[model samples]
Target: MSLENTRHPAGPGLDELVPSRYALRVGDIDVLVVSDGILSLPTKMLAHDADPAVRAAWLKDMFLPPEMVDWALNVVVVRSGDRTILVDAGWGADPNLPRAGRLAQRLEAAGIDLGSVTDVVLTHMHMDHIGGLLVDGIKDRLRPDLRIHVAAAEVEFWASPDFSRTSMPPGFPDALRTAAKRFLNEYRSQLRLFEEKCEVAPGVVATRTGGHTPGHSVVRLASGGDRLTFAGDAVFTVGFEHPDWHNGFEHFPEESARVRVRLLRELAETGELLVATHMPFPSVGHVAVAGDVFRWIPAIWDY
Candidate 1:
């Protein structure tokens, strides 16, 4: 699949609509990469105990430019037999965040509408990923018909009355308290939680991969002997380069590392395409195990 960005009225200070990236098809599923803009952060901000040489090597390997790293929010849309499943909603219209709020238009560009989405698979409840779930009209609001699929632990944690006020770890912000609270308040009733591993549908299975959040998950799509995994935040930017690097945004840093290490090994050993929400554009690639380390080999497609 190819991405084409058409011009649309800027939401606030933006000049034009941003383009999207497409990962084409995997057997019966069509994966559309929707761009929700990007976030710029310093390398050190990702990890507190970063080793200088390892960090530099990771940056070099990923072809990351110096100074800052900009991560694009790549939302995944899966069109299988009869399912129009959206992996995660992008950040919605926020005046302060001009780069975001383009998922709706991007979806239209990919020939999809909010109403056409049959199921929503939320990996976790991060602001940038879940902000677009609600229709934010200036005065009135519109809610789409979507049966949200989430990890039972995640739903329970975020929906708990005390979750919002609970203090987060060092790297996390207090404002996450408020945002998560709002998300739960608005969508709790609409959410359907699943256990460790379950078939969300015919060929779509929800895999248990946590640590980024209490109940973060990765999705597996299998058809005709082919499989693809939609990994939410299981792996971060540095992890793409240095699989050992632990991202600070994780709810449980050590647990996240353990899961990623094992998951990456399995993915490489299987030689299947993996889609990440923040692993460059299109974010679909295969893993190559090099001795004890791993490399991300991006899928080639005609633009």
Candidate 2:
């Protein structure tokens, strides 16, 4: 169904319209999951080198379609005391790609004003993640005042002209260049580039977990004893079931796998809330360690 066709009333199975957003409070810090809608990609995008049987088994286990991979666009909203921070913007409208551009309404539904967003913590520079940074309804320029935070390496990789000429896949160089220029022109002052670890705010800190992108990072939110990791796209679909399986969308698959393994293991051991961008709806859960493998247990809310 198209973004406009599906209507998800408060119910189960995550109906198409207005997918669920969940929130949890920890010592005055509110972590909210804002739905940006979902999109489908070719199944091969999940694993480039896996055996067909292995891929088939993964599809069967997840009850996903064998031909298409469904991906959810989830943007995290963190309300820490006085700051209303948005981590990783969602998908803007694209004629070629259908099921996107639903974030603005969802943010409204969550009672979050775009103008009120003080900071944007990016995990990477992928289009699906950063496309929403640009103003949609308006014709020109992105939000000028919003502090858009990203890793230095990520900004360098995506913004570099050499990257567009040397690294971008065939037929994508022009598009990449356009995007790079747009980011540079529209969000220059708002862009706060950081290296390694940097404290974004009082409750959130950028953790170095590069691989998905050159300088991809995850945001860690902690208050009192409760903590949560906004794991952007470190691991996409079936992240726990196959943390070793490198995502095809990642810039460096090998490095991404290493980072995934380390991050998953740590989250499993520490028992922190894992908020992933692409999981099931309201992608809030905990990773359980079983022997050397990890298991994803979805949140069982009282609502």
Candidate 3:
């Protein structure tokens, strides 16, 4: 239901109107899943190559609307030892996506101060992943010495980016390019470019798995006997069942599919907790091997 039509107790802040964050632990690390808000987009973007009938059936089975969908935007905060790391900033202010760009306010509501963050591990340079840092005065709030970790290949790719395969709505290509360029130009001095992987904290490592983008990466957290993965945009709600489906926004659809399958297989084999950028709120779940396809087993809320 639309928020306008749905009833709720009076509240001034968005976080109070509805839940915006979830806290959990991984070995010795603390993780908080925060909502940047949501994006409403055409359902065709979900799988541009799928047969209309098949895609329709899948959406119907999932109980999602056939024409449009509200995609969740989740940003993760990881705290380990003396460092607090931000994983993928949300779209700070996209004129087209008014519902999103709530990460700054949401982070504050979650008690995560911007200046307190020591590092940022980016999965890619997608607008939704880096636009929050570009928000007005965001740089002032962040410590000048903050380290931003991202794949060197990702930086290189955006410099001469190609969008021959994507099937986005009008204006998205230009918007994405502009946002990525602006972010890099603004944060070039703070970037800690890595070729393959980099240890962001005591227990967090971001590994490049070029598929969705040349520099797309996933962060893995391990400590003691517990493990979790912040998959960024590498995984999604529909990825488990249709790993081969080409998301319209994927730069390399085939490679993205391969990466998705491989990641799903590894997560299933290891039985690690998985959190992704576009899954439902508090996207904490486990991957399971269900015959030939994978299944998403959401974790029971600790509360």
Candidate 4:
């Protein structure tokens, strides 16, 4: 596979509508990369406290604006045999994040019915990752067949009494805790929690790689001889080049950096396809050791 250096246009006021879906066949399993839309985060909000000059240089090299970073909200959908699994729910019609909440639309474009999703494997309880699980404040439990899988430690951490006291911007932690509780209560019967590593589906396994959040995880899918890892925010493109540059949203920045480096090295050596949730639209790629750090070579459009 040849690497293509395709630079996506970036700036304010640009039309946000781009191809929001991509398809790949991993042996017998079908995988789809769906977009919820783009999120415009101030460059400073990410990799916070890093030297401004260093951050600006990296942005310049990547052709991104130094003031703001536009990140694609990529969600993974997996269909293995009889199961239709969604990796992470997108922002889902959230009023605060007007640009996002388009996952339902993109799923329809990909010919996936919302009712057909058998399982939702969440990497963590971040709003963007779990917001789409509900529609109009209602969990789609009428189907009775839909199940939600998350890490046990994640649920414990968020549900703990002290979770709301975490050092976060004013009401953010409280809001997060509320959202998590709502999701858990709404899907209580359908909720399943795993620890360390365990199979979530026939060809899918969830491995705990906490750092970004207390119980953040990455899901691996294998069928026949092909493998793919849904690396849910383990790092972004910039993180590959500088694993030490921590995201401001990380619960444990130091541990997040350590996990990022370890995972990147392992992914590079194994040569498995990695799908990052916040890289670029269709954030599927391969990792490679580049000098002292790592590099991301995006997978060619497999459509």
What's the lDDT for all of these models? 0.71, 0.73, 0.89, 0.79
57-92: candidate 3 lDDT, tens digit per residue: 999999999999999999998889999999999889
Residue pairs in candidate 4 whose N, alpha carbon or C atoms collide under 3 angstroms: none
**Superior by lDDT: candidate 1 or candidate 3:** 3
The prediction achieving the highest TM-score against the true structure is: 3
User: lDDT of model 3 at residue 157?
Assistant: 96
In terms of lDDT, model 2 sits at: 0.73
Judged by whole-model lDDT over C-alpha atoms, candidate 4 comes out at 0.79
- Per-residue CA lDDT of model 2 for 1-303, tens digit only, reads 112222233234334444456667655577777777787776766776678789988898879889887788888888776677888877777776667756766666555567777778888777667777655553233345667788888878775534311233355547646766776677777788888987878878887688787888999998998889989888665657777675666767778888988898898888988888887668788888776677887778634
- Report the lDDT tens digits of candidate 1 across residue range 110-187: 555566677888888877778887546511222355678888888776654233322334544654555677777887
List the candidates' TM-scores in order.
0.85, 0.87, 0.95, 0.89
Q: In model 1, which range of ten residues has the least summed lDDT?
A: 1-10
Better of 2 and 4 by TM-score: 4
Residue 50's lDDT within candidate 1 is 70
Clashing pairs in 2: 6-17, 7-17, 8-17
lDDT (tens digit, per residue) of candidate 4 on 1-303: 001111232234332456777778787788888888887777865677679998888889889898877878989888887788889998777677788888876665555667778888999988779888866843643357777888888888777734321244456667677778887787778878888887867889889999888889999999898999998988787887788886867888888889899998988989999998898878888999976699899888753
